[model samples]
Target: MNKNIITLEYRISKLLRYGVMLAGALMFVGWMSMLDFTQNPLLAFHDYREVTFVHSIGYAWRDKVWGLLTAYAGLILLISLPLSRVLMTAILFWRQKERLLSGIAFFVFAALIISFSLGIEL
Candidate 1:
């Protein structure tokens, strides 16, 4: 493997690990916040039963639920990490003059974008 490829691999691994840890931390904060108000950990589950991916962020923001907002932010970050990796791969492939791999990486990135957009309900 090229040195650049090895470095990219290490960076991508770190990105994934940090993304997961951040998401988990945000969720834990949200859970703890709910516990503060409800006095029971299980009660926190009820608050999010009706939450949906598209609306939760806005709702959390509007409601001023710091925990929920942070949790949603973490989720968004988690989702974007892979997209970032795909983008990085494309860039690295392009720099390496590997046109075919670069094109494929770009195609995958585009597909991910389209799928994410389609998932949102109007």
Candidate 2:
């Protein structure tokens, strides 16, 4: 039982580490590619505008802006990591019959969902 728990924890940690690494790599690639793009960085900064997420995604796609797309993907993955981790933990705890821990994990997962879904930007 002890060894099993250790192995499960190791696996979970490994998953999280790999997820971070992947997200970092993607962001790095996107940033590097953005540097190589034709736009002048200073000019882009001067023309800064706020756009909704859906509009940004559509523009990135329509304009064939691979770097922006890659960067956005990485950002999304990085942002979602914690939520995924919590959900995974909840599932694993439930599977292991850890009633209290599982309940806590599930409650946390729900809270995260609610926060993201219904959270107000102040």
The candidate maximizing lDDT is 2
lDDT of each: 0.81, 0.84
Model 2, 89-115: lDDT tens digits are 888888888989999999998998788
Among the numbered candidates, top TM-score falls to: 2
Query: lDDT tens digits, residues 32-87, model 1?
Result: 66456446556656754665665876777788988777766677787888899899
Each candidate's root-mean-square deviation in Å? 2.8, 2.7
> Which residue pairs collide, candidate 1?
none
List candidate 1 stretches off by more than 4 Å.
36-55
What does the lDDT come to for candidate 2? 0.84
Q: What TM-score, over all chains together, does every model reach?
A: 0.78, 0.84
Model 2 spans with C-alpha error above 4 angstroms: 36-40, 119-122
